[model samples]
Target: MNALAAELRGILQGPVLVGELLGRHTTWRIGGPAELFVAPRSEQELLAVLHLLAQVGMPWMALGTGSNLLVRDGGYRGAIIHMGALQTMEFRDDGTARVGGGLPVMRLVRQAVRRGLAGIEDLAGIPATVGGAVVMNAGAGEQAMAGVLQGAFLAGAEGMEYWPAARLDLRYRASAVPADRIVAAAILRFSFADAEMLESSVQHRLSARRKAQGVGKPNAGSVFKNPPGQQAWRLIDESGMRGRSVGGAQVSEKHANFIVNRGGARAADVLSLIGEIQETVRGRTGIMLEPEVQVIGEA
Candidate 1:
């Protein structure tokens, strides 16, 4: 271990795991070990860890639920800060919530439903952290975080500060939030709604997702962003790439846009399959599909 690793292990308020396999953390169930993995219990601890990382000039990456991520087989050389321990969830007297970025988005959805709040009912099915959702503007159809997110708390070299949602430039499964900073928390504004109506909407979305997606398999949700006026699944299906397989990775037959691990898929297999789909779709439709899934680390 290096001097920096030695110091961090001694000072951090949480576990500093060495050679931690990322496959155990991601939804895809694939990836090699990270050089160091830290799960800070409080915002102060998180900042301290980041400060130490900056002092040593060691690269670091923020980890959410790893829903839409692909970490390569060679693993990441930098430190990974898992935000699961930053699980604060506070509801206000007004119809808004102050949530820890690490809270599972669906858990937030359930809380909102219980509170008879609207805005994120349609997002009940997405497997993402609130922080990840904000970064990607995760949504389905016409509903998205942009509609409810009021502001975010960001921490980086400049220290922690709040930025309103309008300033974040969120749009279409993407956000302008800098990749280097960590989202510590967010404020979401919601409206009062009939409890029955909210529950109905949540269930409907969840059911629709289960029916349309590959449910029993381990996979990130969608592999490609839908092009304007065209769904990615439709394009992939039209290109005759449905059910395509590369090693253990397979483009889901149930939903052509999702790539699933049939049991033991490697990150390389998933990447190769994504490439094949992109090539075939572009060749057929003259439109390129952008990947919604974030790929990281090495091959």
Candidate 2:
């Protein structure tokens, strides 16, 4: 272990894993290991760790639920700041909910539904954390985190600061949250709705998602972004790449945009299949497919 990593272990109030297997954390169930993985229980602890890392110029990445990431087989060389322990949620006097970064997206949706809050029902079946959703501007149908966000608490070397929704340049599936900064919490504005109506809406969306995109396989949701005026799944289907397999990874037959790990799939298998799909779709349809899933670590 290095001097900085040793210092980090001493200072942190949470469990620090050295050479932690990252595959278990990610939704794809791929990746090798992280040199250092720290999960802070509180915002203060997270900030302190961030300050120390910045002072020493140590590399780090803020990991949420690991929904849309693909860490390479060689593993991540830097520290991973895991946010799974920061799961706090509370309502504000202004009728908005303040949710911590580590809170699961599905849990938040359920809470909102119970409180008769609408707007986030579309995210009922999405597998991610609130921080990841906000950073990626995650959405379905016409609803997105961008539309319901009031403000966000961001932590960095300078400490925590609240930024309004306007500051987070939310494009289609992207956000303006600085890459180096970690999302601490967010204030979301929700509309009052009938409890029964909200519950029904959430259920309907979940059921539709299950049918359209099978919940049976172990997959990382959508792999590619939809090109302008074109859906990614339709394009892949047109290219006849659905059910295509590389090693143990297969393009989901139910949803062409999703890549499922049939069993014992590795990072290399997923990447190879991704490349093949991209090449095939591009060569046939002339539309370049862009990956929505973030690929990290060594190739």
How well is each residue in 1-299 modelled by candidate 2, as lDDT tens digits? 56777787787888888899898899989888998899988999999999998887878999998999998998998889999988899976565999999999999999888888888888888988999999999999779998789999999988999989999888899999998898899999998888789899889998999899884767889999999999999999999999999998999988999999898998999999999999999999899999999999876
The lDDT for every candidate, in the order shown, is 0.90, 0.90
Q: Candidate 2: TM-score?
A: 0.97
Instruction: Report the poorest 10 consecutive residues by lDDT, candidate 2.
Output: 1-10
lDDT of 2 at 113: 86
Against the hidden true structure, what lDDT does model 1 obtain?
A: 0.90
Model 2: CA > 4 A from native: none
> What's the lDDT for residue 157 in model 1?
62
Cα lDDT, model 1, residue 207:
88
